[model samples]
Structure formats: structure tokens, C-alpha cells
Target: MIRRIFPYPVLSVGFFATWLLFNQSVTPGQLILATFFGVTSPWLLVRLDAPPFRMRRPLMILRVLWTFAKDIAQSNLRVAKTIIASPHPPPSGFVRIVLEMRSPYGLAALACIVTGAPGTAWISYDPVDNVVVLHILDLMAEDDWAASIKTRYEKPLMEIFE
Candidate 1:
């Protein structure tokens, strides 16, 4: 009963908070609407055939998160230096990376991580070939980027999701 009522309680709470923030109100009517959205949004998503989210190793999340934060900081610095200090414009190119993560959730997370970081943009992903085309502001070596993405992000994500 509890599980059915709160399929995604954390998401529900977040949605409720977002609703309150958007409305900028705590009146009874707004509260009721917020509560309704909080409870029904997840239910609607489930009804829409959303995949069940599962984390195989929750402990690995800390390590992955730490690495992600460090990478973001480093990438920002690299991008900033390239833009500000480089005598010539940095090389740019699209590198096709073959993704190992098959799960939709895992792939989405990887896309977010890559695109969220500075200097890299996720252009397109080919589901049939499991390849992602990423545009880099400062192109160095394709092999190096592939190796970095595979070892640094994909491996850990695979452990977590698959």
C-alpha cells in the first residue's frame, strides 16, 4: 500500500517543493495543488511506461560523484585557459564514442555528465550502433578521449547500473 502510494517519494517531495517555489505561495489551494502534483506526477510517469530505476551498488555513488565533481572543475579550468590564453583558436572536432552502457538510465546519465562538463557537447547518439557523437572545443586525440570516457565514466556507471 505504501509503495503504491509513494512509488517515488523523493521525486514526489522534490516536485512538491518545485511547485511551491513556482507558485510562491503556501495557501490551502496551492498546497492542495502541490500535493496533488507531487503524488500524481510519479504515478503518471509510471503509467507512461517509465523504466524502473535501480542502483546495483549504492556505495559506488560516492566515488562516482567525487570523480564527477573533480572532472567538472578540471574541465572548466582547461576550457577557460584554452579560450583566454591560447594564441590560436583551439581545435574542434566531433569524436564518435562507442557506448558500453545499454541501459537507458545509464546512457542518459552518461550523456548528462559529458554534456554538463565544460568544452564537451553531446551532439547525437546512435542507439543501433551504441555510438555517441560528442563535439569537443579543444580536440586532442580521439583515442585518448575514448579511453578517458570509457575508463573514467562508463566503467563506473556500468558497475552501478548493470
Candidate 2:
């Protein structure tokens, strides 16, 4: 009974708090609405046909997150330097990278990592060939960019999600 009532207890509490915070009221009506939102939201979520996901190596998350943070900082500095100091416009081009991991969750995470970087963006992904085109602001070498994405993001995402 408890499990059915609260599929995700923490998420329910978060929704409850967020509703109250946004409304800025503890009146009886607001409280009832907030409570309804908190409970029904999870029930609706459960009804969605969302794909199942299981983390294969849950502990690897910390390492991947650290890498993402460090790289974001470094990429921001590199992009800033190019913008502020470079005499000529930095070379920019798109590189196609072949992805091996097929899990939707892993692919989505990879997309986020690539698009989140300051000087790089995810242009398009071809599902037929499992290839993703990434636009890089500082295009030194296509092979280097592809290799970096494979090493820094794709591999870890595959390990965790696939």
C-alpha cells in the first residue's frame, strides 16, 4: 500500500516543496493543491511508457562527473582565450564520430556532454550509422576531437548505462 502510494518519496517531497515555494503561500487551498501535485505527478509519471534504465557501474558516476566538470572549465578557458586573444578567427568545422554504445540513455548523456562543452556542439546524429556530427570551434584535428569524445564521455557513459 505504501509502495503504491509513494513510488518515489523523495521526488514527491521535492514537488511538494517546489509548489509551495513557487506559490509563496501556505493557505489551505494552496496546501491542498500542492499536496495533489506532489502525489499525482508521480502517479502520472508511472503511467508514462518510459524506457527502463539500469546503471551497470553506479560507482563510476563520480569519476565521470569529475571529468565533465574539469573539462567544462578547461573548455571555457580555451574558448575565451580564442575569442579575446586570437588574431584570426579560430578554425571551426564539423566532425563525424561513430558511436558504439546503443543504449538510448547512454546516447542522450553523450549528446548532453558534447553540447554542454563551451566550444563544441552536437549538430546531428545519424541512427543508421550510429554516427554523430559535432561542430568544434577550434578544429585542430578531426581524429583528435573524435578520440577525445570517445575517451572522455562516450566510454564512461557506456560503462554506466550499457
Candidate 3:
């Protein structure tokens, strides 16, 4: 019953906070409306049969976020350099990366991290074979790219989600 009332606590809190922020003042009408929407949305979502997520390591999630931020900054600089150096055109292509992390949340995080980076974009994911196709703005060496992704992103994601 309690779970049904608040199926997604984080989402509910976010919706409520957004509502208050948008209104600029938390009047009774706004509060009631936000509460009703937040509570009802979760109940409707629950009917769609979503599995519960278990976050294994909260600290590791923080670490992943920090690492991702650093990578994004570095990639942005690298892409900028490649773009400015017109003599040597960037070798951009798609590469399939075999994934080891099995958790849905981990995969979702990985997708966001890859797509968020300026030089790299996630194209598609194969759930059956656990592989992801990514397009890089500059492709130097496939082996090097795969190794770096595994070491830099996949390793931390494995620790956090798996």
C-alpha cells in the first residue's frame, strides 16, 4: 500500500520540487496539484511492470559521475583540436564495444556518459550479445579506444552497478 502510494519516491520528490519552482510560490492549490500528479504518476507507472532498482554502491556512483565529468572535459578539448587542425581530418566511424556490465541501470548510465561526451555518441545497443555501437568523432585505434573505455568507464560502472 505504501509502495503504491509512492512508487517512485525520487521521481515524486523531483516533480513536487519542480512544481514549486515553476510556480515560484507554493500555494495550497499548487501543492495539492503537484501531490496528486506525483502520487498518481507512480501508481500508473507501477501498472506498467517496472522492476525495482537496487543501487549497490552509492559512493561508487559518485566516483563514476566524477570520472565521467573529467572524461567529458578531456574529450571536448581533443575534439576541438581535431576540428581546428583541418590538414589532418578526423577519422570518425562506428565501433562495436562488448559490454560486461549486465545491470540495466549501469547500461543506461554508460549510454548517457558516452552520448554526453562531445566526441563520442552511442548509436545502438545489442542486449542479446551485450554489445554497444558507438560513433567517435575521431577514431585513431579501435583497440586503444576499447581498452580505454573498458578501463575508464566500464570498470567503474561494474563496481557501481554490478
Whole-structure CA lDDT of model 1: 0.91
Q: Which candidate is the best by TM-score?
A: 1
lDDT string for model 2 (136-161, tens) is 99999999988988998889889999
Runs off by more than 4 Å, candidate 1: 1-7
Order of quality (TM-score):
1, 3, 2
Give me the runs in candidate 2 sitting further than 4 Å from their true place: 1-9, 21-33
Q: What TM-score does each of the candidates earn?
A: 0.86, 0.80, 0.82
Worst 10 residues of 1 by lDDT: 44-53
lDDT for model 3, please: 0.85
Candidate 3 residue-wise lDDT at 11: 83
lDDT per residue (tens digit) for residues 50-150 in model 1:
57778998888788789889999999999999988999998899999998889888898899999999999999999999999999998899999999999
- lDDT for 118 (candidate 3): 96
